[model samples]
Target: MRALTVKGVRIDDTFAEAFGMRATAVIITADSPRWAHQAALTMTGFATSVIGCGCEAGIDSELTAAQTPDRRPGVRVLLFAVSTAELQKQLQARVAQCVLTSPGSACYAGLDGEERLRLGNALRYFGDGWQISKRFGGKHYWRIPVMDGEFVCEATTGLTKEAVGGGNLLIMGRTAQTTLAAAEAAAAAIAKVPNVIMPFPGGIVRSGSKVGSKYKGVPASTNHAFCPTLRGAADTALDPDAACVLEIVIDGLTSQAVAAAMGAGIAALVKLGPRRGAVRISAGNYGGKLGPHQYHLRDLTP
Candidate 1:
C-alpha cells in the first residue's frame, strides 16, 4: 500500500470503527455563563467512556443569552449510552444531581425527535408535590423550587438512536510535548463542529484501551501496542522515533457529524504539520467487527 501523507504527517490507511448509540442533548441555562459552564462541567465530569462511566458526555457548545429558551447564558451538552434505558437513567440522574443543584439553572431540550428521554419529568419528584407544571410553546416544563429560586426543566428531551460513538484519531509524535500539542489542536478543531462531543478530559485521551485486558473479567485495558515504553516488549505499532501517542475519541448525533468532526481535526493536524504536531496519524478499530460505521483516515484527510 502507498503511504498517504497529509502535509508532513503520515496518514495511516486505516479507519475508525464506531458503534451505534442512544443519545440525547439538553440545554442548561443559568444566571451567568460561569454558572452554566459550572453545571455542565460537573455533569460531564467522570463521564468519559461507557465501559465504566455508564455514559459518554461532553459540552457540545456554549450558548449566549439570545440562543437559549429562557434568554440566559447556557451550554448544550450531549450524552451517549449503549442503550435507551441506560441513556434515560444517566440523563435523569445527571440532570437531577448537577443541573438542578446549580443555582439559577434551567434545563431545556436541545434536540428534537420523535423519541424522548425523561428530564424534568423524573426530577419533579424532588419538588415534593410543590413542583409546578407549565405548558409553554407547546412544550411541558416543570418548575421546582430551590434555595436560590426555582429550577425550570423541560419534561423531556429528544433521543436519537442513530447516534455514533467511538470515532477517534491516534496522534503519534517524537515527544510527549509535540504529541500533546497536536492532540490539543485536533480537539479545538473538533470542538467547533456541531452535533459532536469529545468526552475525554480536555478532549484528549492518554490512556487509550483495546477491547479486553490480560486479566479476566476486565472488558478493556491499556493499548500496549501503542505504548512507546513497551515498544520491543509488546506488539508495537509505533516507529522507533515515536515517544508518545494521544487519542481523540468523538461521539456525534449522526455519522456525518462524526466524520465532519474527524475531518476538521485532521485538517488542524495537517496545518500544524509534522514538525510542530503529529509525526503520524492513525485510527483505532477492531478489524471492522466493532461497529457498522468505519471512517477511513484517507477519506477524512484534508
Candidate 2:
C-alpha cells in the first residue's frame, strides 16, 4: 500500500503489516501530575517491547483531571504482545514491579470483554488473598488493600485477536517548534476517535528506532532514514532543508480502526503543516515485512 502526498505532504510507498497481538490497557490515577508521573512512569518503564520487556507498553493518552476516577491527573497505558498467555505473565510482572511499588497508585483495566481473561484476578491474589472485587457501572474492579490505601484496578483486560500494533505517520517541518505544533494538532484530532490511541507523549516521538544497532548489546537503534542529523547513512530520506520530524505510533483492535485514526490524524495535520514548517507527512513501514494491514494516505486525504 502507498500513502499520498499533496502540497506540503510527502507520502511514502510502504505498508505497515501488523500481526495479531494480545493487548491490555491499565488506567492509573494519582493526586497530581507528579504522582501521576510517578505511577505512570514506573508502570511503563522497561516495557518497550515483549521481546525483552515481555510486553510492549506505552502511555496511550493523558486523562484530564475531571476524566479520572478521583478527579486527579492520570494516564491510560496500553500493553501488547504476542499471546494471551504472555499477556497474563507480562501484566502480572508489570503490575508487581511497577504499580505495586508506586505509592497512591491505582490501576484499572482499559480493555475488557466477554471473552475469557486472567491478569487482574491472578495478580490480585498477591494481596495475600485478601483482595476485594467490586463491580461498578457494569465494570468489574478489584480493590487490593495496600498500606497506602487501596490499589484499584480493573478485573480483566479486553482481549482480542489479530490486533494491529504499528500505525505511524511522520510529520516533517522546517523547525522543531513547527513540527511539534503540527504533531500536537494531529494528535488532538486522532484522540477524538475511539478504538484507537497514540502510545507516545503528546503523540510524538522525536527519536525513531530501527531494527538493530552496531553498538554493543543494542538490539534496536534509531531510524536514521527519518533523522535529519544522520544524512550519510546511504539512501536516507531526510529533506536537507528539514529542521525536524516527529512520529506518531498508533494501536487499535483492528486494522480498520487504526486506519481511521491515521486518516483523521493526517487530516488534522494537513491543516497545520505549512504554517508550522510541516512540509510533508508520511508513514513508516518495514518494506512489507509486517503481515496483511495497509493504510494508504491517498484514501485518507481530506
Candidate 3:
C-alpha cells in the first residue's frame, strides 16, 4: 500500500494493537431527545478503557422516532467487555442505573436477534413481583413498574463475537493548546463515522497510558515518553517543535470501522493545516506483544 501523509504530517508505519472484546448494542429512549442523550451520556460515563473500567462503551448514534422501537427519539450505545459474562453484568447494571432511572427512559436491544444475553430477565426482579412481561413483534419485553409509570426494557440483547478494541492515534503538536485543538477536531470527525465511538472524554486522552507501570499494583501508567513536560527527564519520542501530545483511543464494532475512524481523524487534522501545529500522527503498541488486530496508519488513509 502507498504511504499516507498530509500537510507534512507523516503517518506512522506501525500499527495499533487491539484485542478481542464481547460487545452488546443497546438502545436508550426517553420522553424527550434531551433525556435520551442524558441517559446515553450517563450510561457511557467512566467507560473509556477496559483496563481500569472493566469495559468500554460509547454512543453509536442517535435514532429518529421512526427508527426506534417505540417510535420515539433514542440513542444507540455499544458496550464491550472482556467476556460475555462480564458484558452481561455491565449491561444489566448500566441499564438499571442509568436508563431505567432516567425519567421516562427505557432500554431495548439494538442488535438484531441472534446470540443473546438475558439482561432484562435479570433486572425484572427490580419490580418486586409487580413487573409484567409482554411479547411485542415476536420479542420479549419487561414492563417494570416504577415511580414514573413503567420502564419498558427488552428481555435479551444479542452478543456478538469478541471484536477489536483499543485502536488509537497519537496527536503531537507544537503546543498544548494547538495539540488539544487538533485532537478535538480529530475526535469530532471520528464521532461522525459509523459503527465506532471515541470512548474517552471529548474523544481525547491527555494522560494516555502504557500497558504496565513501575508501581507494583498499577497495571498501567502515564506515557511519559510523549509527555512534553518530561522531555528532558524521560525518554521522549516527541519532535523538537512538538510541545504537547494527546491521544485518541477508539473501540469499534469491527476492525474496518476502527480503521475508517482513524483515517477520518487523520483527514480532519490534515484539514486543520500544517500551521495548526499537528506535527506527527503515531499509534500505541507493545512491540506486537499485544492483540491480534494490527491497524496500520498508512494503509488506513491510502
Candidate 4:
C-alpha cells in the first residue's frame, strides 16, 4: 500500500479499527434552528464514548423546514450503543429529558429501519390522561400537554445494526495550540461530510485512551504513548520534534462514510501547510484486536 502523506506531514499507514454498533438517527425539530440545536446539543452531551458514557452520540446535520416532518427547523442526531436494548434505554431517557423539555421541540424517527424503539408511547404518561395520539400517514405521534404547550413525539425510532464507530486520526504538532488548531480545522471539514459525527468536545479529544488500563477496575486509560511528557519514559509514539498531540474521533453510519470523513479531515489539515506545526497524522488501534472494521490511512490518501 502507498504511504499516506500531505504537505510533508507523515500519515501512519495503520488502520483505525472500529466495531459495529447499534445506531439510531433522531430528528429533533423546534420553532427555530436555535431551539433545535439546543435540544440536539443537550441530548448528545456527555456522550463522547461508550466506555465512559454508556453511549456515543452527536449532531449528524441540520435540516431545513422543508426537510422536517413538522415543517420546522430540525437537527439530525445519531446515537450509538453496544446493543439494541441499551440504545433503546438511552433514546427513551435522552429524548424525554432533553428534546421533550426543550421549548417548542418535537421528535420523530429520522431513519426508516424496521427495528423500532418506543418514544412517545412511553412518554405520553407524563400528560396524565390528557395526551392524544395522532396518525400522520400511518406513523403515530403523541401530543402530551406541557407548560408551554404540547410536546409531540413519535411512537418509535428506527435502528441500524451494522453502524460503525471509533474511526480516528491523531495530529502531532510542535505545540499544543498548533495541534488543537489543526484539529479544529479538520473537524470543520469533517462536519460537512454526510452520515458521520465527531462526538468529542469541539470534535477533538485531548486525552485519547487505549483499550486497557493499569488499574483492574478501569477498562481504559490515557494513551501514554501519545503524551508529549512521556516521550522517553513511556515508549512514546512521537518524534524528536513533536511536542503535543490531539485526536479526532469519528463515528459513521457506514464504513464508507467513516473513510470519507477521515479523508476530508486529513485534507483539511494539509491545507494548513506542514510548516503550521502539525508534523504527523497517525491513528489508534489495538493491534487489530478491537474491531472488525479497519479504516486504513494509506487507502484514504490520494
- Per-prediction RMSD in angstroms? 0.8, 3.9, 1.8, 1.4
The CA lDDT at 50 in model 1 is: 95
Model 2 lDDT-worst window of ten = 11-20
User: Could you tell me the C-alpha RMSD of candidate 1 in Å?
Assistant: 0.8
Residue 121 displacement (Å), model 2: 2.1
* Candidate 2 per-residue lDDT over residues 1-302, each given as its tens digit: 34356666666555444556777677787767777767777777776555667766766678888877667788877777788888778778877788777888776666656664555576688788789888878877777888888887777766777577778888888888988888888888888766666666556778777777889889878787887876775667876767788988777767787888888888887766576647777777677655567776667777
Candidate 3, poorest ten consecutive residues by summed lDDT: 1-10
Select the stronger candidate by TM-score from 1 and 3: 1
Candidate 1 lDDT over residue span 1-302, tens digit each: 35598777999999999999999999999999999999999999999999889999999999999999999999999999999999999998899889899888999998999999989899999999999999967999999999988999999999999999999999999899999999999999999999999999999999999878879999889999999999999899998878999999999999999999999999999999898999999999999986999999999997
What is the per-residue lDDT of model 3 for residues 9-73, given as tens digits with 9 covering 90 to 100? 76677888888788889999988899999999999998988777878999999998888999999
Model 3 clash pairs are none
Error of 1 at 92 (Å): 0.8
Q: Give the TM-score comparing model 2 with the true structure, all chains together.
A: 0.78
Give all candidates' CA lDDT scores: 0.95, 0.74, 0.86, 0.89
Arrange candidates by TM-score, highest first: which order? 1, 4, 3, 2
| Better model by TM-score: candidate 1 vs candidate 4 | 1
In model 4, state the lDDT of residue 7: 73
Best of the candidates, lDDT? 1
Which has the higher lDDT value, candidate number 3 or candidate number 4? 4
Off by more than 4 A, model 3: 1-4
lDDT for model 4 = 0.89
Off by over 4 Å in 4: 1-3
